[model samples]
Target chain A: MSIRIDQLPRDKFIMPGTAACPGCPLLIGLRQVMMALNGKMSLVIPAGCSSVIPGMSPATSYGVPTIHVPFASSPAVASGLVSAVRMRGNNGPVVVWAGDGASSDIGFAALSGAAARNEDLIYILADNEAYMNTGIQASGTTPWMAWTTTSPNGKTEERKEMALIMLMHKIPYVATASIAYPLDFIAKVRKASQIRGFKFIHLYAPCPPGLKFDDSYTVKIAQLAVETGIWVLWEYNQGKLTISPPSAMYKDKSKRKPLSEYMKLQGRFSKVGEDAMKIYEAKIDAYWNTILKLSELYK
Target chain B: MQETIQRQARKVLVGDHAVAEAVKLARTQVISAYPITPQTLIVERLAEMVDNKEINAKFIRVESEFAALASVYGASAGGARAFTATSSHGLFYMYEMLWWAAASRLPLVMAVVTRSLGPPWNIHDEHTDIMAIRDSGWIIGMAQNVQEALDMTLAAYKITEDSRVLLPVAVGLDGFILSHTAEVLEVPSQEVVDGWLPPRDPHIPYVIEPGGEPITMGNMVKSDAHHMLLKKMMDEAMDGAKNVIHDVFASYAKLTGRNNGDLIECVNCQNSDYVAVATGAWSGDIMKAVSDLREEGYNVGFLRIRFLRPFPEEAIMDVASRARGIIVFDRDYSTGLGGIIAAEMMGLVPQSVSFKGVIAGLAGVDVTPSEVKAAIKDFIDDAERNGPIRIRKTWLMQKMEGGKP
Candidate 1:
């Protein structure tokens, strides 16, 4: 379905001409998420490209109060910001928008702690696969068989499972979304504002620069990720499970595009063989089955 | 200097609970804490009070020491009076945000139960934990007792909220010594405590507001000029905290019928030649030891440091100029350096005075009044016969080597 600009919320979150690269998926994801969240939102960005995307000076696109904290402190900082809002009797929702590097790697300790404590806030991880801000460095979330400066011949392990780890905390809300599905992303973020206990939203954002793909392919790649069962859309809420139905790309599983297409676009995954691909497939299947079992148990 | 009036009141209360009561009296709007030994009582009391709606503040149970401080920082930056508590290991855990709170100029206040740093897994009174992050830009204060801890907590707000000194403060109290020991505390009326520290202003804007808005906080701006400008402001505020702390103590004195002075207090050194300088709870023992030595015709004095961070240099210099010998009792080691306080005192005094580094009571090691007396006698005898003890580098290094890995 072609998205209509008029159908989208008319409100502007980040003004035009911001520092985000021309086809940055995080910027697009942030714009929609902010619009859905509406007024009175505190954004805590940890150290990463998305954290610095607001720009330093002369030009800033974000229309709300955004604070960029240290790399490992986004969740902790957001928890503080949320408590401050509560202390001040402010009804505004506290939101944390962190990159995968900051959220899954350096920030894991703080993030896990905040979720376990059930701090009243919404934390969103804009996962662009790797640490795009630091020249496409491999992070814990960097998929297996993904190449990067450090992971010269593709990543050796499976991506870190962040959402499930947060789920173990029994948070009030935890959901996954992709920029390609704006409505789902917006709905989850907007709903997160109404909830009380800790809520997390993981957005699968495509990076043209980091992925070494054409700038215009950002949205298409995001769609392909979800449809390929590579980035599933699901939520764990109070031990309950809810998965968004597959999109058009998953209508025919037999004709589903190969994972190689996604890997071929990104420089981080330039090298891969049958052995590595098999391991990747097995990991994905196991993760998928685990999610299915969780859904069954919770349902 | 003379033996002064001591308001010796007896009461039994855990250190954490006492500090919590003080925090309550100060009317902190946000109370955040994570459970850690020697400091858990402080948060538990606040949490119970919050559960019963005894205090108007929100009590948030954070996951880690880092989150506890981060929550306080956020709330404080949002213009609410915020507080948190942690001990040794916890303090080390929150080191990063401790600096963040200070550098951002948030009027955040925290109580640190000084416990020995880990390795041997001991939970006892030691200054090493708090002193480890001394340069993290916090206005540091040492509490001699529960009452002092209570009073200093309010004083922290007075110093931090003062426009001239908008910096975070960490009020340190010895862990097992001050935290677990019970003592009679003259609990002031809520009305009086409220009057002493006014309600926090709610309208002040935070560095960051909700919903992706932009605010000029620790923003990355162009130019070294901007960098130095912020640093200069922070430096100026720290300089201003000295007078602000004194004034805050003065106001509290008026309300609570107590008085605290800056720099060092001279006890029994009026016509004496020797003085022992100490801080925190040990000062009481040191003073008693000095009084006994004075009765024996031994000219002895006690210099009690009221403020540790903005080290009262002028007052220290004045006291050292008069005293012939100085014995510095320090509870924290610098690891490769001498006792933290002893090293600091050495730099403050003139070379003429004999200085003895009495490094004891570390990691909650017991130091009784008699031990203080012995140290004082040794210092006086050395001063009278061989002159001032010459400075030694290897001794300082030896002190460092004693630190636990």
Candidate 2:
């Protein structure tokens, strides 16, 4: 179930010289997914950073048919496209590339409905954890104690466990991948494209401007996030959930790099107090434990 | 032509069922719907028809009204003839996507089974709901009865799919008044509908395909010029729809010999002393009142404004200029601006014509032919005594909100 390093597609469908910020993880993830799909998918994008990145009017960066939907309607709109295509006997998958804000906050109802109906779609929720496109506002999936425009003094609420929430709908495939691990994300996208029903990929994308980090540190920050057990890499294929290779070693808490090591790289965690840190760590521990339980229970 | 008549069938149906019948006859490819009161029956009939294999279409049952319209929008963009139905709050909930559909020029057809919006939670009829989206660039029309609802919906598909007017059309039928009221409906053969309304050209705006050449729809441009031109095109289309509506109505009449009306239907406006103007099912009541008044030696006329977006200015001007006065009966009020239909007439009619806006039948209050006759008589008596008034509006409610106006 692994793709060799040399076997990756040469053509990254997302052309360079677009509007993406320096070290934009969404762009990276978009390129990987497009490469995996090989530009053979109709894209349904909602309001997010990718909306602008895919190119504005007369020119497009991606060499595929893309339809920009409203902020809250990517899944439902894709459901329509899929249905129409299926009616025409064209069983090609329609992919929805959306941000955490659209999928987790404003568009949760549509997202849930699409999952429940098992609409044939590959919905990639590119999670930057905040409304980065709208200038770093807090969203439902914005992490606990993360500094965002709306959650100015550290968020009052914990971020939602969206991957687990999507899994609860019993979709055919649910996976979590980070931009730091392109091979894993590419493999997940490739696997998902073969599935018949609703398949969701929670892509962990980092934001340099939003997270108060340097442009050069984007990949390193994402790498630290995975190493520190902040973002777990796993895949729930059909009903069997298994932790992916990139995150398997971190299952043992002691092997994980120090949480402080990961936090110091970003300014979002700068003002995080000891009490907030303890709560944040506890939430991460609880989340991983729950994932472990779910993987076993489904197995 | 003879073969087309052989496919015609007659059925006793409510407005909702009639809409379903029209959609089937038009051979709609994809239908997405969410159930709302007053509009629920339309989808229910459509669902059964789809399941029973009576109609070959994809019936998508969506979670909300927003998704209902959004799905159809996507389907239309994907080169399929699509439809959706909703009412009142449902229409309001789906309101944002309606602009998307209209602006994209998707040629979608939506039936608004019109109902009064809530709190104190009412479920009956009102034009205030449908009139809310007048400026939304959609081709808007109101059906006077069940038969008109069927014919109008079929014509809506033809009108919207026309190359000159590649925009969506919303045909509104009053809540229980039309949606639930059963009447004899003459359904033209599928062959006739197919001959009249061809399948939508997928390349109008271009359809989305997997392996097809790359096309990005609705992308943000640096300049507002293209966006401005799109809105300008909508205006041109609205103007251009007048000819399409007439042409469609003419061809449809020739095929079925049932020429209901086009844009605005008038009754005896030729040198009439006064012309009563209105829309919706109450137009029938107004017409009866005009006929009664004409028999009583008063040269009065009735004019029903069919299509709202195009406004039917020329026809309205013809009737308005000939009459000594025009009494606009509106079932909808624009709140701070008096009646909606009244406001349109007030803006359009000749400056010399005496005008009065009689706002009535809001929130499902019944306005019979006698009440309409009485209102017309009151307006004539006042106009006969006084000279031509510039603009006047009167509230015709039993219990005026904070007392009489």
lDDT tens digits by residue: candidate 2, B216-335: 888898678988987898899899999999999999987887887788887777578898988889888899998999899887988888888888888888787777999999898887
Q: Considering summed lDDT, which 10 consecutive residues are worst modelled in model 2 chain B?
A: B1-10
Docking class of 1: medium
For B1-405, candidate 1 gives per-residue lDDT tens digits of: 011112223345766777888788788888888889889888988999888988888776777888788878877766678899999889988988888788887788899998887789999887888878777788888888887887788778878887778788888888878888887775666776676678766444345666333563554555768777878888777778888887887777776677656444556644567777778877888888888888898878777876677667777777778878777888877878878878877887778888888678876777788877977787688778998674422121123465842
Q: After superposition, which runs of candidate 2 have C-alpha atoms over 4 Å from their true positions?
A: B1-7, B399-405
Tell me what fraction of the real C-alpha contacts between chains A and B each candidate also makes: 0.53, 0.61
> Local error of candidate 1 at B12, Å?
4.1
lDDT of 2 at B332: 88
**Candidate 1 lDDT for residue B39:** 90
Q: List the residue pairs that clash in candidate 2.
A: none
Chain A superposition TM-score, candidate 2: 0.98
Candidate of highest TM-score: 2
**If chain B of candidate 2 is superposed on the true chain B, what is its TM-score?**
0.96
